[model samples]
Target: MANAASGMAVHDECKLKFLELKTKRTHRFIVFKIEEKQKQVIVEKVGDPTRSYEDFTASLPADECRYAVYDFDFVTEENCQKSRIFFIAWSPDTSRVRSKMIYASSKDRFKRELDGIQVDLQATDPTEMGLDVIKSRAS
Candidate 1:
């Protein structure tokens, strides 16, 4: 489906892969990129379930805008194991202004397609969405 604001269509594979991650924990994280020429969002990479959060973060480009989803597993104060799905909007400070604007405008629509996201994070730098931040939010 195409988002009205940016006229960016999401590829079918995007949702399919997300469903695998959400329901079966098939992936640790999924990175998505906007293909301006195609005017669509496409799956850039899929991290293995054994991958660390640091590996997921490393998948994002140093100076680009992208979107990602991560399945975070953590233990509660009561020692209960739980998981939270996070939708991340990544717009680095060094990215092009046009790219940032496009991502910002289309973020909500794109995120809505993923049915089970529990936490929403917007990060311009790595520090903003650090492990501590995710852990705190998951708690």
Candidate 2:
């Protein structure tokens, strides 16, 4: 394994492609609030409080940063790739969402993989990811 500061164990060709891929694609870009002291991030819906969720960023208490945030909307399962995220709908077709996270990874395979992360959405089933549903009928 490469040292934490040195770099990633990746090839040059892949590096070039990674750059292009990331530049070409953007992530879901959901709104979020960061709690450094608590190491927590809460993902909120756009102008919709009834639909929202929160998740823990770290196991131990540590100082976190917004740079640690990520997209989670392109999920195939509950809490997609992790890092507090979301995805863009690829097409009008309901099934194949854009899944921006994949593009982010392709851009830099080992740039800074923030593993062991989670994202909370307003609904139990994130309408996009299909997690659970929250009864936010509106006040």
TM-score of each: 0.98, 0.19
> Highest TM-score among the candidates is held by which one?
1
* Predicted candidate 1 versus true structure: per-residue lDDT over 21-105, tens digit per residue: 9999999999999999999999999998999999999999999999999999999999999999999999999999999999999
Clashes of 1: 0
Clashing pairs in 1: none
| Candidate 2 displacement at residue 122 in angstroms | 17
* lDDT string, candidate 2, 65-120, tens digits: 11222233333346544233322221112222232232223222233332222432
Q: How much is the lDDT of residue 105 in candidate 2?
A: 30
